[model samples]
Target: MLEGRSCLIPRPPLSSSGDQESTCFYMRYGIIKEGSEEEEEDEEKIDDRGKRRKSQDLVIASSSREIQIEQTPHERNDYSSVEDLIAPIGRDISINCLLSCSRSDYGSIASLNRSFRSLIRSGEIYKLRRRMGIAEHWVYFSCNVLEWEAYDPYRQRWIALPRMPPNECFMCSDKESLAVGTELLVFGKEVTSHIVLRYSMLTNSWSPGKEMNSPRCLFGSASLGEKAIVAGGTDARGNILSSAELYNSELQTWETLPSMNRPRKMCSGVFMDGKYYVIGGMASSTEVLTCGEEYDPIRGVWRLIANMSSGLKCASGAPPLVAVVNNKLYAADYASKEVREYDKVNNSWITLGRLPERHVSVNGWGVAFRACGERLMVIGGPRGLGGGMIELNSWIPDKNPPLWIMIASKHSGSFVYNCAVMSC
Candidate 1:
């Protein structure tokens, strides 16, 4: 009934010894005038008087008699309107309120206005969210080569990502994925050399990843916050390596780190108890390693832990499938289809329970075991189905044994080539 008129939503006046004026934000539609014919018609259409009162309560006339209609220059052609993110409420306060919003709503929020779109795309909001300890974990995985998808467990929704740029050589090659901050890095070999592909949630696009100082494949890698550590993998020459590197997603750069005491390949990395651990790898083609190394970022040193992964590895199996949740290390024993938890006191593993019966893996390949927030997620599907189906099962660790529950499933290739969990 108040169409085409601007309405003011006032903020409560601050209580102070000195007089403090209150501010209000403008809404595109104004309130219905009291005693107007439109109000009477609207009241009759709405049966609940409380509902009508609540609707009218949202708008308030200001005493200061100052009104503002904020507008910013249209820097880009795609923007429909160049208004302040939330006019009258300053940018800082507006961002603070936005920070508390669910990340799943970001796509819709970005579409609301030009300033919001810019803020979300600039990646500044995520950085601030990290600082404020607001994080949402989303699973990113690949079933078919060059195709990736993201699952938001909280919202129970799947987000399809842009297909990776096509390259026959890279498609057939072995690949590794790590999700750090707002970026997901996929490492693989082209016909002639190693290559890294990065997917960004902010831009919702893929681009060439920054190459490492020493490019290697089949490395042990894990991410904590905005940085990730990659260590102990074979070089391009297929020689096992002890060299390591650290990557900062914000700066999009990699720094060479001190090498481990031993060279290994096909190892798994995890962040536990505020440190990075490289567990269960092969020193050579014939020698399997049970020892794990712990890297202390504060001390800038790697401490070797003997027999740390003694019983976790299998003969000729993929590197120990491991994940860390709530600073506790856990491993998925694919051969036995069981889960084990690490005891830091004794440096041993305790059998927790079995993985989901439907979860299938071949020598630890094709399946993904990852820590999603506080839950352990197992991603895979049964073997030999005419049309494949991927299932996502998760269990929260507790005193009671793990109770695997199906979070979601979809018709896709049963084999999961690479997977990573990004929390920001």
Candidate 2:
């Protein structure tokens, strides 16, 4: 596991060279500039939270606070020591392409809670595998026809996994097609536009479980405790669905839960604080939505929460990234570069760190959430203002507050950043 580091600096541009290729890519903090007394004063003003506002230019410092790198490439290299020392794999390490990018957008990544000191520097291609919970040893999902691919950071090359359930089509269906708990669970498929198929991951392979009560697709599914919850999506006939169900793995049965107040599909669903949050999705109009809601299984009720600051339309649905840290829900909005942290206690949301870039599609928002020891690793996802998926970064910086870092991905035009941080 990557241990936490202390010194902080603004997120660096992800391009091969730190230099900006075009105005399209902007830095949250740029150079402090020369002889701007007023600009320096403007930087000191505190906003509502008393935190200093973003400055057009910022200085980069080493942990010792002595070495400062201000818009200089060679000087920037000096700071790499601290970053390289703590990274899971050195910045230049190649990785294996476990699966193709088409099948599974959110390729699975986990920390061993142990670091590979000897091999990391040896430059040998090796896979550092971690054991997930009891049942799920590996999990990968793709909604596209092509196989899923991922960079094996240790190997420093790309690799692709086998096609999912040959002849069985996952891309065509809408049911909650994601892995949760210890295994990847495929709940239902939009078969015949009315019927749905049920499947679950067992021993690295997917097999049919049982058919769902109804056929639906493009919905949200999450695993909390022993129950896998499937919620809101469009049915086979192309009608939006508000209904939800719980699949009890122990009993191999599906039981209907209280449906959502509104019919929706593509909403983000994550299990946090013993409850599930289904947020931001398309409505009947097929337009993006900002409404948010929470479901408590124990209470057997659903309660509406504060709406998102802005609407998230279908062009960009919330692709997971909804994680719980210290009991708060934090997620990156696909439509917006902002990563919002939800306050369950206060029933509100606070903006965390900005993504540095906003993803525009389901594939672009495919960033997976990971934690190496104490350092948070947000891998893959797209880049730029236009939504181009690229594998990037494994570390999030802290001094800037929300811990944001950018790294490149192995898959072309596909990026991943999952909020489901799990323990193996």
Q: What tens digits encode model 2's per-residue C-alpha lDDT throughout 1-424?
A: 1112211112334332122122111111121222356433533331221232222233322222322223233332232252332233333331222111111121111110012222222212111212111111122434245344333222233333334464445445333445433334444443454433233211222455555686567777766544678788877677889999887654667899998887887777766677887877778554666777789988989887656424434444443445444345566555565666665566566766666443334533455544322344455545453434454344343445564544434334453322232222
Off by over 4 Å in 2: 1-146, 149-162, 171-176, 187-191, 194-202, 286-288, 308-321, 356-400, 405-424
Clashing pairs in 1: none
**Which prediction has the highest lDDT against the true structure?**
1
Residues 54-161 of candidate 1 have per-residue lDDT tens digits of 322122122323234333332222233334455555576567666766666666566444567667777888898787667888899999989888886755667777
Q: What TM-score, to 2 decimals, does candidate 2 have? A: 0.54
TM-score of each: 0.81, 0.54
Considering summed lDDT, which 10 consecutive residues are worst modelled in model 1? 20-29
TM-score of 1: 0.81
